[model samples]
Target chain A: MRDKTILLVEDNQDDEDLTLRAFKTNNISNRIIVVRDGAEALDYLFGEGAYAGRDLSMMPTLILLDLNLPKIDGFEVLKRVRADSRTRRLPIIILTTSHEQEEVFRAYESGCNSYVRKPVDSAQFRDAVRDLGLFWLIHNVPPPESE
Target chain B: MQTKRFAGGLRIALVLAGIFLALASGYLAGIREAQMKASGPALTRDLTIVLFGQTLHLRLSLSALGVTIIFVLTILLAAAVLFARVAHRRRRQVEAVNRKLMREIGERKRAQDEVIQLNAELEQRVAARTRELQTANKELEAFCSSVSHDLRAPLRAIDGFSDALLKDYHDKLDEQGQQHLQRVRNATQRMAQLIDDLLSLSRVTRTEMRREEVNLTAIAREVVTELRQIDPGGNVEVIISEGLVAQGDARLLRQVLENLLGNAWKYTSKQPAARIVMGTCKGRNGKPAFFVQDNGAGFDMAYASKLFGVFQRLHSASDFPGTGVGLATVQRIIHRHGGEVWAEGSVGQGATFYFTVY
Candidate 1:
């Protein structure tokens, strides 16, 4: 259960609430650490700034990353995370509102585990978030040395 | 100009020499007296002679001097005449060459002027097109991103919170309130579909095209398979012709077939037995056109022209739910491939969409 922690990086408050509700509705009982921006996400991941005294060994097993963010964008965050050995093997899923094909290709090219378009329909969005949670948390096998 | 001027000078010199020869031979006495003084002993000796019964004191040396003078003058005159003729011929040749050069210069000047005019026109056209493209591109970019990010975000919140109200406040609210929330959710979903459809239409215009040998039959079959998966209860009989191939972007062409076949499947929902046929046949202009024929709720011929216009629908939302952008997208993609699309249908009969790609 400790190793099944999740990191959710989202900017919009409504989307954040909806995502939390989706996980709760789907009965995914993993501990989720939410970050408002890409900078906070990096800080949380590296245990720097606001999270300086926090233990670095307890890394989140899965990350739900949003493409559009303030202070630092999603692509940059993905690059910096993949560059570091500590968070390199973490499963990162891109959840974005953009339906652009070029953006999708770029996200995959930048090394995201999965890409999900945040559908405007509530049920579809909820279903998508639930599927991502179930697959990454319970079913799919993470890298052996990731923890 | 130099050759022509040189020829004129030579003619003037020739004419002056001719006047000098005339003065010396016919009227100039001082020149003849000098010639006689310069004669040698044999040229000066004169003898008595009789000619035609008239005795004339004829100095033999004098006759010899006259004959010698006459012979030299005749030779000089003949040489001058020959030189004049040669100079005239040379001048005519130079004049002819000068005229040819002037004509060539005129032609080159005309060609250069034409080229400059053409270049100016082309530059103007290019500038106009660039400005138009820039404006269109900027507008499309703003519209697409705003709709993708901003518009959908609010709508999703509304839908999500509405669902929450229905789920969490189920007992507090009356039955009608729950039903109203459901209606609101469905309305949001429909609006989301409209947004998606608009985005798709924009993408049809914006997406870059890659032409290849696309197996159209394979695409149609795949679309049909997906359609069947989406609606497992659909019992429509579909018949696709063999070896339907085209040179175009496969993804766009797949969208084309999907929209057409999807519409066919949708309109034929009320029919007991629906039949759809996809094949190639000659179009109205006698060109080979790929057609999708379906026995469905057809349209009137008078309103047919409005079918391909964006947001124009012949059927009501209750009967045939659509954003009315599918046919417009199909037309745009077909036009992008240097092709055209048209449809023919009579009310209560069926609809057949014919498209040709080059």
Candidate 2:
């Protein structure tokens, strides 16, 4: 399960549920872990707080980050993750409702692997989620694991 | 300017008068010398008869002439002295007037300098105020973008969740519950549309306009075609004149045409045979104005002033669906191009929107 784990950092419960449903409908059966805020995401990433005893070597293959979070925000999370060697090469995708060009530019500038706008229509959103899951989980090869 | 000319005329007149006085005094002195010469022989004859000195008559006449000549010369010298005194007084008066004029000119220069200084200060103040206004506008633009970003998130959540419920839990819910959920979804979608329209309106204000020669006729044709595609069965008659051009941002002008033509199309939906015309005409100010006229459900003239305002609507949502931001966006785009937009309409008759790019 080293590269099959997918961590989703999102504060809104409704969005989290919708995303999970989209993945399930698309048959993306990867072990999915959810963190509610940016700080918790950081804690889980560095193997601290509730995730202290967890093995740091078993890092997730992809991370879905929401920009508007309760603590530290998605940009700061991306920055910190890219700064550390353990999670620096982790493929992080910004999954947000904002289609603003500035936000997209900042996400890519902050080392996000991809940026996707959350569609208001459920069918379109499902399709977008399916495509993303298939592309990152099945098609794209992951970076070599760092010691 | 008149006073300076008058003063110059007076100076010339005084100099001429002084010269005339001097010449007249000289002529009088010459006449007195001639009279003394003519009476000289008679005076000598009278002296010879009275005295036993017939031989001394010439000497007496000569002495008498000398006395007369001396008296005449003294009177002439006195007259000359008086004329010189008068001329000197006139010169002093003219000099005093000249000094007063020089002082007035100095005062005028000071006043003019004060005016210049005041103008400079006012210009500086205007520049500073303009800078302040620019800064405020920038801040407002930043605030608007962030607000739009924040507002869309929750709307998406509501829309997304309702859609999930309807798709996944349809079997568990009753008919009433399903309708309620559908209404919720509809309301959320409408709200989302409103937010998007609001964002576009704000963007119209902040976007830097790129100006170029735009083919207004072509743009109108494109917009009308799109509208027709939207309602493929629409029996509306569209008439577009050729060679309508304007100088403005092409993208923004397209938006203007879209809003105006779209509005005309929507309002005329109830008409059996609707007519829409897009063309150019001379405006009230005699400038070339492009207009979109339609035989639609026109509005009241009294409420025309509120037509371009944001969120202002004359018709009910059920009759016509809109966020009421289209016209406001159109007005903003036109105003950015230094243009004016106004509408004329009569209830149940028709409406026309006119705009001119300066």
Best-matching candidate per DockQ: 1
Name the 10 consecutive residues with the lowest summed lDDT in model 1 chain B: B40-49
In candidate 2 the C-alpha lDDT for residue A143 amounts to: 94
Q: Write one digit per residue (lDDT tens) for candidate 1, span B195-268.
A: 88889888988878999999999999999999999999989999999999999999999999999999999988
lDDT score, candidate 2, position B327? 96
> How well is each residue in A66-111 modelled by candidate 1, as lDDT tens digits?
9889999888899899999998988999998886776788788888
Model 1 TM-score relative to the real fold: 0.77
Candidate 1 residue runs with Cα over 4 Å from true position: B1-139
lDDT of 2 by residue, B1-358 (tens): 5456456556655655556556655665566567689865333424433456446444454445555455556556656655665677679889999999999999999999999999999999999999999999878766765676677767767778787788779999899998998888778777877887887788787777888899989989899889989899889999999999899899889989999999999999999999999999999799889899999999999999999999999999889999999999999999999999999999999899999996
State TM-scores per candidate. Answer: 0.77, 0.62
